[model samples]
Target: MTQSTANFKVGNEKLIKVLDGASSHLRGLLEKQGRPDGALRIAVIGGGCSGLQYKMDLVDGPRDRDILVPSNAVNVVIDPKSALFVSGSELDYSDDLQQGGFKVTNPNAVVTCSCGESFSA
Candidate 1:
């Protein structure tokens, strides 16, 4: 894990809650990818059907000015800007044949796309 030189506090496990399913899946993915020490990065990006979408990636660790949250024994990192959109959100996973993937339930979102891949806050 890369250490940030900044001194500001970034620990906020409550920012986005990671459900059991999501945590388990993320841990497995990190292990398979040979990055058990890595963290999951969640960001809000524009250009989705609803004007906003979520982008996730497995990263080595939190960067400078990044918020590092620990939930369900998993580490999740978010940039300062992306934190605004994902605050008070919940991340979950599903193994259903049709909707099998990670999903974020954001309380700030007022409208979500029918595909469940985008939202408007």
Candidate 2:
């Protein structure tokens, strides 16, 4: 993985708290899922019901174009391609069963679904 000089900051208190919680959950899931060296990867991809969708997973390796951010003892990797769509966005986790799990709040999203899973930028 090529580390760029781009010192991206994972700001926002609520976002950080959410990321920390998500990191804890992800770490446990990864351990249970069985990959000691893996990390939680988040990306924006095309072709959802909307124009774009958020994609996340536990990945063991980083590609050349991935932008890396560290949060709560975990490495958060965002692909360079996806960064264009997700830049200036905040990641948050909701414990509410009705809207549980991680959620991405993108300032760049021109349109977003009620569930906040899909968007049009």
Candidate 3:
């Protein structure tokens, strides 16, 4: 297995928190896709209304520069570069009437779009 150079902690908590709703949603998706062993990979990439966007996916395993963070019962993986942008973020799920999906609460973000889908640090 490839090793990671990224640090996985921020103050008293892990870099990110995969809340129960998000973890359950991820587990269900993985089960349906027959990839129960898969992990949720969260990365920040260029391009969005606010300049930076969050890209998430269910990955089979960790890459060479991935920081593995265990949250709830889910494994949250972050690339080294993305890790810096989301160091003190929380991965959560929302089931509201209008907007419902996985949301990233990132403390490192200096400015975020109105929809909360993108941000700039």
Candidate 4:
């Protein structure tokens, strides 16, 4: 369960990067949930106003077809199907007054909702 950030590359391409704030937040959640070895799973599911929604959760391990991206002290797990939409995105954490939570800055998104929870590629 110990991985370095430099090991997050997929072939010759770099996968998503998790900012320090997001990694800290996720690590705290895993500790609180008593799953220090758990990983954060990010997936794209059909729903939301933009037709595709990003779903995230803490899981004990990666599922079949998952791409493991390590960042700092946390590991981000994304399924292959979801990776198509989230590739090159940054997993960030924000505490701004307007919006405060985990956010995805996706370059592939054609349109993203104001809430930052859903998008279309």
lDDT of 4: 0.83
Can you tell me which runs of candidate 3 are displaced by over 4 Å?
1-13
> What is the lDDT of every predicted structure here?
0.88, 0.72, 0.83, 0.83
Residue range 7-77, candidate 4, lDDT tens digits = 23332126688888998999999999999998888999999899899899899867655788777778888
TM-scores of all models?
A: 0.90, 0.74, 0.85, 0.85
The TM-score that candidate 2 achieves is 0.74
| Pairs with steric clashes in candidate 4 | none
Ranking of all candidate structures by their lDDT, best first: 1, 4, 3, 2
Clashing pairs in 3: none
lDDT of 4 at 28: 92
Report the C-alpha lDDT of model 1 over 1-121, residue by residue, as the tens digit: 9954643246675689999999999999999999998889999999789999999999988887889999998999999898999999999999978877899999999999876679999
Clashes of each: 0, 0, 0, 0
Model 2 per-residue lDDT at 19: 59
Which candidate gets the maximum TM-score versus the true structure?
1
Which residue pairs show collisions in model 1? none
Alpha-carbon shift of residue 42 in model 2 (angstroms): 1.6
Better of 1 and 2 by lDDT: 1
lDDT of 2 by residue, 17-113 (tens): 2256676777787788788667667878886777899989888746665666666666677776777787777676778889798888888889988
